[model samples]
Target: MNKFTLLNGLVVPLDRANVDTDAIIPKQFLKSIKRSGFGPNAFDEWRYLDHGEPGMDNSKRPLNPDFVLNQPRYQGAQILLARENFGCGSSREHAPWALEDYGFRVIIAPSFADIFFNNCFKNGLLPIRLAAEQVDALFKAVEAMPGYRLKVDLERQTITAPDGTVYPFEVEAFRKHCLLNGLDDIGLTLQHVGEIAAYEAKHRAAQPWLFA
Candidate 1:
Protein backbone atom coordinates (compact mmCIF):
# COMPACT_ATOMS: atom_id res chain seq x y z
CA MET A 1 0.00 0.00 0.00
CA ASN A 2 1.14 3.57 -0.71
CA LYS A 3 1.68 6.19 1.97
CA PHE A 4 -1.18 8.72 2.19
CA THR A 5 0.40 11.68 3.91
CA LEU A 6 -1.29 14.42 1.87
CA LEU A 7 -3.33 14.90 -1.29
CA ASN A 8 -4.56 17.92 -3.25
CA GLY A 9 -6.88 17.30 -6.18
CA LEU A 10 -10.18 18.13 -7.81
CA VAL A 11 -13.33 17.24 -5.91
CA VAL A 12 -16.08 15.26 -7.60
CA PRO A 13 -19.49 15.74 -6.09
CA LEU A 14 -21.52 12.53 -5.94
CA ASP A 15 -24.68 13.68 -4.26
CA ARG A 16 -26.40 10.32 -4.28
CA ALA A 17 -26.83 8.25 -1.16
CA ASN A 18 -26.82 4.48 -0.57
CA VAL A 19 -24.04 3.74 -3.08
CA ASP A 20 -23.43 0.02 -2.78
CA THR A 21 -20.34 -2.07 -3.43
CA ASP A 22 -21.73 -3.77 -6.52
CA ALA A 23 -22.52 -0.42 -8.09
CA ILE A 24 -18.90 0.48 -7.53
CA ILE A 25 -17.23 -2.38 -9.46
CA PRO A 26 -20.11 -4.64 -10.46
CA LYS A 27 -20.15 -8.45 -9.89
CA GLN A 28 -18.82 -9.67 -13.23
CA PHE A 29 -15.44 -7.95 -12.87
CA LEU A 30 -14.79 -9.68 -9.56
CA LYS A 31 -13.31 -12.74 -11.26
CA SER A 32 -9.82 -11.27 -11.44
CA ILE A 33 -7.60 -12.16 -8.49
CA LYS A 34 -5.26 -9.26 -9.24
CA ARG A 35 -6.04 -5.73 -8.06
CA SER A 36 -4.77 -3.88 -11.13
CA GLY A 37 -6.88 -3.24 -14.28
CA PHE A 38 -10.11 -2.96 -12.32
CA GLY A 39 -10.12 0.84 -12.69
CA PRO A 40 -11.35 0.73 -16.28
CA ASN A 41 -14.49 -0.99 -15.03
CA ALA A 42 -14.76 1.00 -11.83
CA PHE A 43 -18.33 2.14 -12.45
CA ASP A 44 -18.97 -0.07 -15.44
CA GLU A 45 -22.73 0.22 -15.50
CA TRP A 46 -22.72 3.98 -14.98
CA ARG A 47 -19.67 4.77 -17.11
CA TYR A 48 -21.10 2.93 -20.09
CA LEU A 49 -24.58 2.34 -21.44
CA ASP A 50 -24.01 -1.32 -22.31
CA HIS A 51 -22.04 -3.81 -20.25
CA GLY A 52 -18.28 -3.18 -20.46
CA GLU A 53 -15.61 -5.83 -20.54
CA PRO A 54 -11.86 -5.58 -20.86
CA GLY A 55 -10.72 -5.00 -24.48
CA MET A 56 -14.34 -4.41 -25.49
CA ASP A 57 -15.14 -1.52 -27.85
CA ASN A 58 -15.86 1.59 -25.75
CA SER A 59 -17.26 3.64 -28.67
CA LYS A 60 -20.58 1.84 -28.54
CA ARG A 61 -21.37 2.65 -24.90
CA PRO A 62 -23.27 5.91 -24.57
CA LEU A 63 -22.03 7.94 -21.65
CA ASN A 64 -24.37 9.92 -19.46
CA PRO A 65 -23.14 13.45 -20.13
CA ASP A 66 -24.85 14.86 -17.10
CA PHE A 67 -23.12 12.58 -14.67
CA VAL A 68 -20.70 14.44 -12.42
CA LEU A 69 -17.85 12.05 -13.14
CA ASN A 70 -18.42 12.18 -16.91
CA GLN A 71 -18.00 15.95 -17.03
CA PRO A 72 -14.67 17.32 -18.23
CA ARG A 73 -14.15 19.62 -15.28
CA TYR A 74 -14.40 16.75 -12.83
CA GLN A 75 -11.80 14.69 -14.62
CA GLY A 76 -8.89 13.45 -12.48
CA ALA A 77 -10.82 14.08 -9.29
CA GLN A 78 -9.13 12.53 -6.28
CA ILE A 79 -11.47 13.52 -3.50
CA LEU A 80 -15.11 12.44 -3.62
CA LEU A 81 -17.83 14.31 -1.74
CA ALA A 82 -20.66 11.93 -1.17
CA ARG A 83 -23.89 11.76 0.82
CA GLU A 84 -24.87 9.47 3.65
CA ASN A 85 -24.72 5.69 3.68
CA PHE A 86 -21.88 5.67 1.20
CA GLY A 87 -20.30 2.31 0.27
CA CYS A 88 -23.27 0.29 1.49
CA GLY A 89 -24.33 -3.28 0.58
CA SER A 90 -22.03 -6.30 0.14
CA SER A 91 -18.61 -6.31 1.80
CA ARG A 92 -16.59 -6.35 -1.36
CA GLU A 93 -12.94 -5.31 -1.20
CA HIS A 94 -13.19 -4.49 -4.86
CA ALA A 95 -15.13 -1.35 -4.01
CA PRO A 96 -12.05 0.38 -2.65
CA TRP A 97 -9.91 -1.25 -5.34
CA ALA A 98 -12.01 0.32 -8.06
CA LEU A 99 -12.02 3.68 -6.35
CA GLU A 100 -8.26 3.68 -5.84
CA ASP A 101 -7.71 2.52 -9.40
CA TYR A 102 -9.85 5.37 -10.69
CA GLY A 103 -7.53 7.81 -8.82
CA PHE A 104 -9.72 8.53 -5.81
CA ARG A 105 -7.57 8.85 -2.71
CA VAL A 106 -10.02 10.17 -0.16
CA ILE A 107 -13.80 9.93 0.21
CA ILE A 108 -15.72 12.28 2.48
CA ALA A 109 -19.24 11.30 3.45
CA PRO A 110 -21.72 11.86 6.23
CA SER A 111 -21.42 8.16 6.97
CA PHE A 112 -20.19 4.92 5.46
CA ALA A 113 -20.81 1.21 5.76
CA ASP A 114 -18.66 -0.34 8.49
CA ILE A 115 -17.11 -2.90 6.19
CA PHE A 116 -16.43 -0.51 3.33
CA PHE A 117 -14.90 2.02 5.66
CA ASN A 118 -12.53 -0.59 7.01
CA ASN A 119 -11.69 -1.85 3.52
CA CYS A 120 -10.55 1.62 2.48
CA PHE A 121 -7.70 1.60 4.97
CA LYS A 122 -6.41 -1.79 3.85
CA ASN A 123 -6.36 -0.59 0.25
CA GLY A 124 -4.64 2.75 1.01
CA LEU A 125 -7.82 4.82 0.49
CA LEU A 126 -8.99 7.27 3.12
CA PRO A 127 -12.70 7.20 4.03
CA ILE A 128 -13.45 10.27 6.09
CA ARG A 129 -16.44 10.25 8.42
CA LEU A 130 -17.73 13.76 8.86
CA ALA A 131 -20.93 15.27 10.19
CA ALA A 132 -23.84 15.90 7.82
CA GLU A 133 -23.42 19.64 8.09
CA GLN A 134 -19.77 19.42 7.20
CA VAL A 135 -20.51 17.26 4.20
CA ASP A 136 -23.21 19.64 3.04
CA ALA A 137 -20.80 22.52 3.33
CA LEU A 138 -18.23 20.69 1.23
CA PHE A 139 -20.85 19.93 -1.40
CA LYS A 140 -21.86 23.55 -1.51
CA ALA A 141 -18.32 24.75 -1.96
CA VAL A 142 -17.53 22.20 -4.67
CA GLU A 143 -20.75 22.97 -6.54
CA ALA A 144 -20.13 26.68 -6.37
CA MET A 145 -16.86 26.16 -8.17
CA PRO A 146 -16.85 23.35 -10.70
CA GLY A 147 -13.11 22.71 -10.63
CA TYR A 148 -12.82 23.30 -6.90
CA ARG A 149 -10.10 21.25 -5.29
CA LEU A 150 -9.27 20.47 -1.69
CA LYS A 151 -5.96 19.68 -0.10
CA VAL A 152 -6.08 16.98 2.57
CA ASP A 153 -3.20 16.81 5.02
CA LEU A 154 -3.40 13.47 6.76
CA GLU A 155 -0.81 14.36 9.36
CA ARG A 156 -2.66 17.47 10.47
CA GLN A 157 -6.10 15.93 9.93
CA THR A 158 -7.10 19.07 8.06
CA ILE A 159 -8.67 19.79 4.67
CA THR A 160 -7.92 23.12 3.03
CA ALA A 161 -9.80 24.58 0.11
CA PRO A 162 -8.52 26.89 -2.59
CA ASP A 163 -10.12 29.85 -0.83
CA GLY A 164 -8.13 29.13 2.36
CA THR A 165 -11.14 27.54 4.06
CA VAL A 166 -10.02 24.70 6.28
CA TYR A 167 -11.99 21.87 7.83
CA PRO A 168 -10.70 19.48 10.41
CA PHE A 169 -11.57 15.77 10.37
CA GLU A 170 -11.04 12.99 12.86
CA VAL A 171 -9.27 9.72 12.14
CA GLU A 172 -8.32 6.87 14.42
CA ALA A 173 -4.74 6.97 15.66
CA PHE A 174 -3.92 3.41 14.55
CA ARG A 175 -5.23 3.98 11.03
CA LYS A 176 -3.40 7.27 10.79
CA HIS A 177 -0.18 5.64 11.88
CA CYS A 178 -0.53 2.83 9.35
CA LEU A 179 -1.28 5.16 6.48
CA LEU A 180 1.56 7.50 7.36
CA ASN A 181 4.04 4.66 7.54
CA GLY A 182 2.59 2.91 4.50
CA LEU A 183 2.18 -0.21 6.53
CA ASP A 184 -0.30 -2.90 5.56
CA ASP A 185 -0.96 -6.03 7.64
CA ILE A 186 2.17 -7.65 6.26
CA GLY A 187 4.18 -4.50 6.59
CA LEU A 188 3.14 -4.23 10.22
CA THR A 189 4.13 -7.81 10.86
CA LEU A 190 7.49 -7.22 9.26
CA GLN A 191 8.12 -4.39 11.67
CA HIS A 192 8.79 -7.03 14.34
CA VAL A 193 11.03 -9.07 12.09
CA GLY A 194 14.03 -8.90 14.40
CA GLU A 195 12.07 -9.90 17.46
CA ILE A 196 10.31 -12.69 15.55
CA ALA A 197 13.62 -14.09 14.32
CA ALA A 198 15.09 -13.99 17.84
CA TYR A 199 12.06 -15.83 19.24
CA GLU A 200 12.26 -18.49 16.54
CA ALA A 201 15.95 -19.09 17.14
CA LYS A 202 15.44 -19.50 20.90
CA HIS A 203 12.49 -21.83 20.38
CA ARG A 204 14.39 -24.04 17.95
CA ALA A 205 17.31 -24.36 20.31
CA ALA A 206 15.10 -25.09 23.30
CA GLN A 207 13.09 -27.77 21.50
CA PRO A 208 15.47 -29.56 19.16
CA TRP A 209 13.83 -32.90 20.01
CA LEU A 210 10.48 -31.64 18.78
CA PHE A 211 11.88 -30.75 15.37
CA ALA A 212 13.48 -34.27 15.09
Candidate 2:
Protein backbone atom coordinates (compact mmCIF):
# COMPACT_ATOMS: atom_id res chain seq x y z
CA MET A 1 0.00 0.00 0.00
CA ASN A 2 1.16 3.51 -0.80
CA LYS A 3 0.58 6.75 1.13
CA PHE A 4 -2.33 8.80 -0.28
CA THR A 5 -1.79 12.25 1.20
CA LEU A 6 -2.90 14.02 -1.97
CA LEU A 7 -3.80 13.22 -5.59
CA ASN A 8 -4.37 15.28 -8.75
CA GLY A 9 -5.18 13.67 -12.06
CA LEU A 10 -7.41 13.62 -15.10
CA VAL A 11 -10.97 12.66 -14.20
CA VAL A 12 -12.61 9.83 -16.15
CA PRO A 13 -16.36 10.40 -16.11
CA LEU A 14 -18.38 7.22 -15.63
CA ASP A 15 -21.97 8.46 -15.35
CA ARG A 16 -23.54 5.06 -14.77
CA ALA A 17 -24.92 4.24 -11.35
CA ASN A 18 -24.88 1.03 -9.32
CA VAL A 19 -21.62 -0.27 -10.77
CA ASP A 20 -21.07 -3.65 -9.12
CA THR A 21 -17.80 -5.36 -8.21
CA ASP A 22 -18.28 -8.00 -10.87
CA ALA A 23 -18.46 -5.40 -13.61
CA ILE A 24 -15.29 -3.77 -12.33
CA ILE A 25 -13.43 -7.05 -12.51
CA PRO A 26 -15.12 -10.16 -13.79
CA LYS A 27 -15.03 -13.28 -11.59
CA GLN A 28 -12.96 -15.36 -14.03
CA PHE A 29 -9.94 -13.19 -13.36
CA LEU A 30 -10.25 -13.74 -9.60
CA LYS A 31 -7.97 -16.80 -9.64
CA SER A 32 -4.85 -14.80 -8.95
CA ILE A 33 -4.26 -13.90 -5.30
CA LYS A 34 -1.77 -11.20 -6.19
CA ARG A 35 -3.14 -7.69 -6.75
CA SER A 36 -1.12 -6.97 -9.88
CA GLY A 37 -1.95 -7.99 -13.53
CA PHE A 38 -5.65 -7.22 -13.32
CA GLY A 39 -5.58 -3.69 -14.72
CA PRO A 40 -5.70 -4.74 -18.35
CA ASN A 41 -8.76 -6.78 -17.55
CA ALA A 42 -10.25 -4.23 -15.16
CA PHE A 43 -13.56 -4.06 -16.97
CA ASP A 44 -13.19 -7.33 -18.83
CA GLU A 45 -16.56 -7.58 -20.55
CA TRP A 46 -16.79 -3.85 -21.23
CA ARG A 47 -13.16 -3.21 -22.04
CA TYR A 48 -12.75 -6.01 -24.57
CA LEU A 49 -15.02 -7.93 -26.82
CA ASP A 50 -14.91 -11.73 -27.50
CA HIS A 51 -15.40 -11.91 -23.70
CA GLY A 52 -12.68 -14.28 -22.51
CA GLU A 53 -9.14 -14.39 -21.25
CA PRO A 54 -7.32 -11.36 -22.62
CA GLY A 55 -3.88 -12.90 -22.57
CA MET A 56 -4.92 -16.17 -24.18
CA ASP A 57 -5.18 -14.60 -27.63
CA ASN A 58 -4.56 -11.01 -28.57
CA SER A 59 -6.54 -11.28 -31.79
CA LYS A 60 -9.59 -12.46 -29.89
CA ARG A 61 -9.56 -9.53 -27.47
CA PRO A 62 -10.84 -6.45 -29.20
CA LEU A 63 -11.10 -3.17 -27.28
CA ASN A 64 -14.60 -1.82 -27.07
CA PRO A 65 -14.79 1.73 -28.33
CA ASP A 66 -18.00 2.60 -26.53
CA PHE A 67 -16.65 1.85 -23.10
CA VAL A 68 -15.51 4.96 -21.22
CA LEU A 69 -12.20 3.35 -20.30
CA ASN A 70 -11.42 2.34 -23.86
CA GLN A 71 -11.57 5.95 -25.01
CA PRO A 72 -8.08 7.17 -25.77
CA ARG A 73 -8.71 10.55 -24.15
CA TYR A 74 -9.31 8.86 -20.81
CA GLN A 75 -6.03 6.97 -20.90
CA GLY A 76 -3.74 7.46 -17.91
CA ALA A 77 -6.65 8.89 -15.92
CA GLN A 78 -6.03 8.56 -12.16
CA ILE A 79 -9.31 10.00 -10.85
CA LEU A 80 -12.78 8.64 -11.55
CA LEU A 81 -15.96 10.73 -11.43
CA ALA A 82 -18.96 8.47 -11.15
CA ARG A 83 -22.62 8.42 -10.12
CA GLU A 84 -24.29 7.01 -7.01
CA ASN A 85 -23.85 3.57 -5.49
CA PHE A 86 -20.58 2.95 -7.27
CA GLY A 87 -18.71 -0.22 -6.30
CA CYS A 88 -21.91 -1.89 -5.13
CA GLY A 89 -22.35 -5.68 -4.74
CA SER A 90 -19.95 -8.32 -3.38
CA SER A 91 -17.01 -7.81 -0.99
CA ARG A 92 -14.28 -8.87 -3.35
CA GLU A 93 -11.08 -6.85 -2.85
CA HIS A 94 -10.38 -7.36 -6.57
CA ALA A 95 -12.53 -4.32 -7.40
CA PRO A 96 -10.05 -1.96 -5.83
CA TRP A 97 -7.13 -3.99 -7.16
CA ALA A 98 -8.35 -3.51 -10.72
CA LEU A 99 -9.07 0.17 -10.18
CA GLU A 100 -5.68 0.80 -8.61
CA ASP A 101 -4.01 -1.27 -11.27
CA TYR A 102 -5.79 0.81 -13.90
CA GLY A 103 -4.15 3.89 -12.36
CA PHE A 104 -7.13 5.23 -10.44
CA ARG A 105 -5.96 6.65 -7.14
CA VAL A 106 -9.17 8.41 -6.07
CA ILE A 107 -12.80 7.75 -6.89
CA ILE A 108 -15.33 10.56 -6.34
CA ALA A 109 -18.90 9.41 -6.14
CA PRO A 110 -22.08 10.38 -4.32
CA SER A 111 -22.05 7.01 -2.52
CA PHE A 112 -20.33 3.60 -2.54
CA ALA A 113 -20.88 0.06 -1.31
CA ASP A 114 -19.81 -0.35 2.33
CA ILE A 115 -17.46 -3.26 1.74
CA PHE A 116 -15.80 -1.89 -1.40
CA PHE A 117 -15.34 1.49 0.25
CA ASN A 118 -13.53 -0.12 3.18
CA ASN A 119 -11.35 -2.22 0.86
CA CYS A 120 -10.07 0.83 -1.04
CA PHE A 121 -7.82 1.98 1.80
CA LYS A 122 -5.95 -1.30 2.14
CA ASN A 123 -5.06 -1.22 -1.58
CA GLY A 124 -3.94 2.42 -1.61
CA LEU A 125 -7.08 3.92 -3.17
CA LEU A 126 -9.27 6.74 -1.86
CA PRO A 127 -13.03 6.45 -2.18
CA ILE A 128 -14.33 9.96 -1.64
CA ARG A 129 -18.00 10.45 -0.86
CA LEU A 130 -19.53 13.77 -1.86
CA ALA A 131 -22.92 15.33 -2.40
CA ALA A 132 -24.83 14.31 -5.51
CA GLU A 133 -24.81 17.88 -6.74
CA GLN A 134 -21.04 18.13 -6.40
CA VAL A 135 -20.57 14.89 -8.27
CA ASP A 136 -22.80 16.10 -11.06
CA ALA A 137 -20.70 19.24 -11.41
CA LEU A 138 -17.56 17.14 -11.80
CA PHE A 139 -19.26 14.90 -14.32
CA LYS A 140 -20.34 17.90 -16.34
CA ALA A 141 -16.82 19.32 -16.44
CA VAL A 142 -15.31 16.03 -17.55
CA GLU A 143 -18.07 15.53 -20.06
CA ALA A 144 -17.47 18.94 -21.58
CA MET A 145 -13.70 18.56 -21.55
CA PRO A 146 -12.45 15.07 -22.15
CA GLY A 147 -9.18 15.43 -20.26
CA TYR A 148 -10.45 17.61 -17.42
CA ARG A 149 -8.31 17.30 -14.31
CA LEU A 150 -9.06 17.93 -10.64
CA LYS A 151 -6.70 18.75 -7.80
CA VAL A 152 -7.42 17.00 -4.51
CA ASP A 153 -5.71 17.88 -1.23
CA LEU A 154 -6.37 15.30 1.46
CA GLU A 155 -4.80 17.34 4.25
CA ARG A 156 -7.30 20.16 3.62
CA GLN A 157 -10.02 17.79 2.38
CA THR A 158 -10.62 20.09 -0.54
CA ILE A 159 -11.07 19.54 -4.29
CA THR A 160 -10.05 22.41 -6.51
CA ALA A 161 -11.77 22.69 -9.83
CA PRO A 162 -10.06 23.64 -13.04
CA ASP A 163 -11.44 27.15 -12.71
CA GLY A 164 -10.16 27.44 -9.12
CA THR A 165 -13.36 26.67 -7.21
CA VAL A 166 -12.74 24.52 -4.14
CA TYR A 167 -15.13 22.07 -2.45
CA PRO A 168 -14.56 20.34 0.88
CA PHE A 169 -15.22 16.65 1.63
CA GLU A 170 -15.43 14.66 4.87
CA VAL A 171 -13.30 11.64 5.84
CA GLU A 172 -12.92 9.83 9.15
CA ALA A 173 -9.88 10.72 11.24
CA PHE A 174 -8.54 7.13 11.53
CA ARG A 175 -8.96 6.36 7.83
CA LYS A 176 -7.24 9.62 7.01
CA HIS A 177 -4.32 8.73 9.28
CA CYS A 178 -3.90 5.27 7.80
CA LEU A 179 -3.88 6.54 4.20
CA LEU A 180 -1.48 9.35 5.08
CA ASN A 181 0.95 6.84 6.56
CA GLY A 182 0.37 4.03 4.00
CA LEU A 183 -0.82 1.73 6.77
CA ASP A 184 -2.92 -1.20 5.65
CA ASP A 185 -4.37 -3.74 8.11
CA ILE A 186 -0.96 -5.41 8.51
CA GLY A 187 0.81 -2.08 8.66
CA LEU A 188 -1.65 -0.90 11.27
CA THR A 189 -1.12 -3.96 13.44
CA LEU A 190 2.65 -3.59 13.19
CA GLN A 191 2.35 -0.16 14.77
CA HIS A 192 2.05 -1.91 18.17
CA VAL A 193 5.06 -4.22 17.62
CA GLY A 194 6.93 -3.01 20.71
CA GLU A 195 3.93 -3.43 23.00
CA ILE A 196 3.13 -6.84 21.54
CA ALA A 197 6.73 -8.02 22.01
CA ALA A 198 6.78 -6.82 25.62
CA TYR A 199 3.52 -8.62 26.37
CA GLU A 200 4.79 -11.84 24.75
CA ALA A 201 8.02 -11.75 26.78
CA LYS A 202 6.11 -11.31 30.06
CA HIS A 203 3.66 -14.07 29.15
CA ARG A 204 6.44 -16.49 28.24
CA ALA A 205 8.22 -15.90 31.59
CA ALA A 206 4.95 -16.43 33.53
CA GLN A 207 3.97 -19.59 31.56
CA PRO A 208 7.22 -21.52 31.02
CA TRP A 209 5.34 -24.81 31.36
CA LEU A 210 3.00 -23.83 28.55
CA PHE A 211 5.96 -23.06 26.27
CA ALA A 212 7.61 -26.36 27.15
Candidate 3:
Protein backbone atom coordinates (compact mmCIF):
# COMPACT_ATOMS: atom_id res chain seq x y z
CA MET A 1 0.00 0.00 0.00
CA ASN A 2 1.15 3.52 -0.73
CA LYS A 3 0.80 6.55 1.52
CA PHE A 4 -1.87 9.01 0.37
CA THR A 5 -1.15 12.18 2.30
CA LEU A 6 -1.94 14.46 -0.63
CA LEU A 7 -2.67 14.12 -4.33
CA ASN A 8 -3.02 16.60 -7.18
CA GLY A 9 -4.04 14.82 -10.35
CA LEU A 10 -6.19 15.05 -13.43
CA VAL A 11 -9.85 14.08 -12.94
CA VAL A 12 -11.74 11.53 -15.04
CA PRO A 13 -15.52 11.49 -14.96
CA LEU A 14 -17.14 8.05 -15.01
CA ASP A 15 -20.61 9.53 -15.61
CA ARG A 16 -22.55 6.53 -14.32
CA ALA A 17 -24.32 5.26 -11.23
CA ASN A 18 -24.55 1.88 -9.48
CA VAL A 19 -21.22 0.71 -10.93
CA ASP A 20 -20.81 -2.73 -9.45
CA THR A 21 -17.64 -4.64 -8.55
CA ASP A 22 -18.00 -6.92 -11.57
CA ALA A 23 -18.22 -3.95 -13.87
CA ILE A 24 -15.15 -2.44 -12.31
CA ILE A 25 -13.31 -5.69 -13.05
CA PRO A 26 -15.37 -8.43 -14.63
CA LYS A 27 -15.74 -11.83 -12.92
CA GLN A 28 -13.54 -13.52 -15.51
CA PHE A 29 -10.47 -11.71 -14.19
CA LEU A 30 -11.04 -12.61 -10.53
CA LYS A 31 -9.16 -15.90 -10.65
CA SER A 32 -5.89 -14.23 -9.83
CA ILE A 33 -5.56 -12.30 -6.60
CA LYS A 34 -2.21 -10.76 -7.57
CA ARG A 35 -3.68 -7.28 -6.98
CA SER A 36 -1.95 -6.09 -10.13
CA GLY A 37 -2.03 -6.55 -13.92
CA PHE A 38 -5.78 -5.97 -13.62
CA GLY A 39 -5.41 -2.40 -14.78
CA PRO A 40 -5.61 -3.45 -18.41
CA ASN A 41 -8.88 -5.22 -17.68
CA ALA A 42 -10.38 -2.45 -15.58
CA PHE A 43 -13.86 -1.70 -16.93
CA ASP A 44 -13.21 -4.47 -19.46
CA GLU A 45 -16.71 -4.80 -20.84
CA TRP A 46 -17.20 -1.07 -21.28
CA ARG A 47 -13.64 -0.25 -22.21
CA TYR A 48 -13.28 -2.69 -25.08
CA LEU A 49 -15.53 -3.88 -27.87
CA ASP A 50 -14.77 -7.59 -27.68
CA HIS A 51 -15.20 -10.11 -24.90
CA GLY A 52 -12.26 -10.02 -22.45
CA GLU A 53 -10.54 -13.06 -21.04
CA PRO A 54 -7.56 -13.62 -18.80
CA GLY A 55 -4.15 -13.48 -20.59
CA MET A 56 -5.71 -11.84 -23.64
CA ASP A 57 -3.64 -9.22 -25.40
CA ASN A 58 -5.52 -6.11 -24.34
CA SER A 59 -3.39 -3.94 -26.59
CA LYS A 60 -4.83 -5.66 -29.64
CA ARG A 61 -8.42 -5.50 -28.42
CA PRO A 62 -10.68 -2.92 -30.01
CA LEU A 63 -11.29 -0.04 -27.62
CA ASN A 64 -14.56 1.73 -27.02
CA PRO A 65 -13.86 5.24 -28.25
CA ASP A 66 -17.03 6.47 -26.56
CA PHE A 67 -15.91 5.36 -23.12
CA VAL A 68 -14.60 8.14 -20.91
CA LEU A 69 -11.42 6.29 -19.98
CA ASN A 70 -10.31 5.64 -23.57
CA GLN A 71 -10.52 9.31 -24.45
CA PRO A 72 -7.18 10.99 -25.03
CA ARG A 73 -8.02 14.03 -22.90
CA TYR A 74 -8.48 11.97 -19.75
CA GLN A 75 -5.38 9.86 -20.19
CA GLY A 76 -3.30 9.36 -17.09
CA ALA A 77 -6.14 10.59 -14.88
CA GLN A 78 -5.67 9.76 -11.20
CA ILE A 79 -8.88 11.01 -9.64
CA LEU A 80 -12.18 9.46 -10.63
CA LEU A 81 -15.32 11.63 -10.47
CA ALA A 82 -18.44 9.50 -10.33
CA ARG A 83 -22.17 9.52 -9.52
CA GLU A 84 -24.30 8.08 -6.74
CA ASN A 85 -24.51 4.42 -5.71
CA PHE A 86 -21.06 3.72 -7.16
CA GLY A 87 -19.42 0.39 -6.38
CA CYS A 88 -22.63 -1.50 -5.73
CA GLY A 89 -23.30 -5.28 -5.99
CA SER A 90 -20.72 -7.92 -5.00
CA SER A 91 -18.15 -7.05 -2.32
CA ARG A 92 -15.01 -7.96 -4.21
CA GLU A 93 -11.85 -6.17 -3.12
CA HIS A 94 -10.59 -6.47 -6.71
CA ALA A 95 -12.72 -3.45 -7.62
CA PRO A 96 -10.45 -1.11 -5.75
CA TRP A 97 -7.38 -2.99 -6.88
CA ALA A 98 -8.42 -2.44 -10.49
CA LEU A 99 -9.10 1.24 -9.79
CA GLU A 100 -5.77 1.73 -8.07
CA ASP A 101 -3.96 -0.17 -10.77
CA TYR A 102 -5.72 2.02 -13.34
CA GLY A 103 -4.01 5.01 -11.66
CA PHE A 104 -6.91 6.39 -9.61
CA ARG A 105 -5.93 7.25 -6.08
CA VAL A 106 -9.15 8.95 -5.05
CA ILE A 107 -12.76 8.30 -6.03
CA ILE A 108 -15.29 11.10 -5.43
CA ALA A 109 -18.90 10.07 -5.53
CA PRO A 110 -22.26 11.04 -4.02
CA SER A 111 -22.58 7.60 -2.48
CA PHE A 112 -20.91 4.18 -2.51
CA ALA A 113 -21.85 0.65 -1.57
CA ASP A 114 -20.98 -0.21 2.04
CA ILE A 115 -18.50 -2.99 1.30
CA PHE A 116 -16.78 -1.17 -1.56
CA PHE A 117 -16.33 1.94 0.60
CA ASN A 118 -14.62 -0.08 3.33
CA ASN A 119 -12.46 -1.98 0.82
CA CYS A 120 -11.19 1.28 -0.65
CA PHE A 121 -9.66 2.34 2.64
CA LYS A 122 -7.97 -1.01 3.19
CA ASN A 123 -6.59 -1.04 -0.37
CA GLY A 124 -5.08 2.47 -0.20
CA LEU A 125 -7.77 4.06 -2.38
CA LEU A 126 -9.53 7.11 -0.96
CA PRO A 127 -13.28 7.02 -1.61
CA ILE A 128 -14.78 10.38 -0.68
CA ARG A 129 -18.51 10.80 -0.26
CA LEU A 130 -19.90 14.28 -0.85
CA ALA A 131 -23.34 15.79 -1.34
CA ALA A 132 -25.09 14.84 -4.57
CA GLU A 133 -25.06 18.47 -5.65
CA GLN A 134 -21.35 18.74 -5.00
CA VAL A 135 -20.62 15.66 -7.09
CA ASP A 136 -22.77 17.00 -9.90
CA ALA A 137 -20.84 20.26 -9.79
CA LEU A 138 -17.56 18.38 -9.95
CA PHE A 139 -18.73 16.35 -12.90
CA LYS A 140 -19.71 19.54 -14.68
CA ALA A 141 -16.44 21.23 -13.87
CA VAL A 142 -14.41 18.27 -15.03
CA GLU A 143 -16.28 18.10 -18.31
CA ALA A 144 -16.08 21.83 -18.90
CA MET A 145 -12.32 21.91 -18.66
CA PRO A 146 -9.77 19.72 -20.36
CA GLY A 147 -7.02 18.33 -18.13
CA TYR A 148 -9.00 19.43 -15.08
CA ARG A 149 -7.27 18.59 -11.83
CA LEU A 150 -8.11 18.70 -8.12
CA LYS A 151 -5.95 18.80 -5.02
CA VAL A 152 -6.90 16.35 -2.31
CA ASP A 153 -5.42 16.95 1.14
CA LEU A 154 -6.10 14.06 3.44
CA GLU A 155 -4.56 15.75 6.44
CA ARG A 156 -6.86 18.73 5.98
CA GLN A 157 -9.83 16.61 4.81
CA THR A 158 -10.49 18.92 1.88
CA ILE A 159 -10.69 18.78 -1.91
CA THR A 160 -9.74 22.03 -3.60
CA ALA A 161 -10.78 22.87 -7.08
CA PRO A 162 -8.73 24.84 -9.60
CA ASP A 163 -10.60 28.00 -8.66
CA GLY A 164 -9.54 27.56 -5.02
CA THR A 165 -13.04 26.58 -3.95
CA VAL A 166 -12.80 24.00 -1.19
CA TYR A 167 -15.20 21.16 -0.49
CA PRO A 168 -14.65 19.55 2.87
CA PHE A 169 -15.19 15.80 3.29
CA GLU A 170 -15.18 13.48 6.26
CA VAL A 171 -13.09 10.34 6.85
CA GLU A 172 -12.72 8.21 9.93
CA ALA A 173 -9.66 9.16 11.98
CA PHE A 174 -8.22 5.65 12.21
CA ARG A 175 -8.59 5.03 8.47
CA LYS A 176 -6.95 8.39 7.85
CA HIS A 177 -4.05 7.38 10.08
CA CYS A 178 -3.60 4.06 8.30
CA LEU A 179 -3.68 5.63 4.84
CA LEU A 180 -1.24 8.34 5.86
CA ASN A 181 1.23 5.73 7.10
CA GLY A 182 0.53 3.27 4.24
CA LEU A 183 -0.54 0.64 6.74
CA ASP A 184 -2.73 -2.24 5.62
CA ASP A 185 -4.18 -4.89 7.95
CA ILE A 186 -0.93 -6.86 8.01
CA GLY A 187 1.07 -3.70 8.52
CA LEU A 188 -1.16 -2.75 11.46
CA THR A 189 -0.67 -6.13 13.10
CA LEU A 190 3.11 -6.01 12.57
CA GLN A 191 3.25 -2.82 14.64
CA HIS A 192 3.06 -5.01 17.75
CA VAL A 193 5.75 -7.45 16.64
CA GLY A 194 7.78 -7.24 19.84
CA GLU A 195 4.79 -7.78 22.08
CA ILE A 196 3.66 -10.72 19.97
CA ALA A 197 7.09 -12.28 20.10
CA ALA A 198 7.30 -11.87 23.86
CA TYR A 199 3.86 -13.40 24.34
CA GLU A 200 4.80 -16.37 22.18
CA ALA A 201 7.98 -16.91 24.15
CA LYS A 202 6.14 -16.75 27.44
CA HIS A 203 3.55 -19.19 26.24
CA ARG A 204 6.23 -21.60 25.07
CA ALA A 205 7.95 -21.43 28.48
CA ALA A 206 4.67 -22.06 30.31
CA GLN A 207 3.84 -25.02 28.10
CA PRO A 208 7.11 -26.60 27.03
CA TRP A 209 5.34 -29.83 26.01
CA LEU A 210 3.17 -27.97 23.56
CA PHE A 211 6.22 -26.51 21.87
CA ALA A 212 7.98 -29.90 21.79
Assess candidate 3 and give its lDDT: 0.94
Give the alpha-carbon lDDT of every model.
Answer: 0.89, 0.87, 0.94
For each candidate, what TM-score against the reference?
A: 0.86, 0.86, 0.88
Q: Pick the candidate with the highest TM-score.
A: 3
lDDT by residue for model 2 over 1-212, one digit each (tens)?
A: 79998777988988899999999999988888677878877878887877766356534578889999878999899998888999999898999999998899999999999999999988889999999998988888888986799998888999999899898999999888888888767766899999999998899999978778
Better of 1 and 3 by TM-score: 3
RMSD of 2: 4.0
Compose the digit string of candidate 3's lDDT tens values, residues 1-212: 78999999999999988988889999999999587888999999999999999999999999999999999999999999998899999988889989999899999999999999999998789999999999999999999999899999999999999999999999999999999999877867899999999999999999999989
User: Which candidate has the highest lDDT of all?
Assistant: 3
Report clashes for each candidate as comma-separated counts: 0, 0, 0
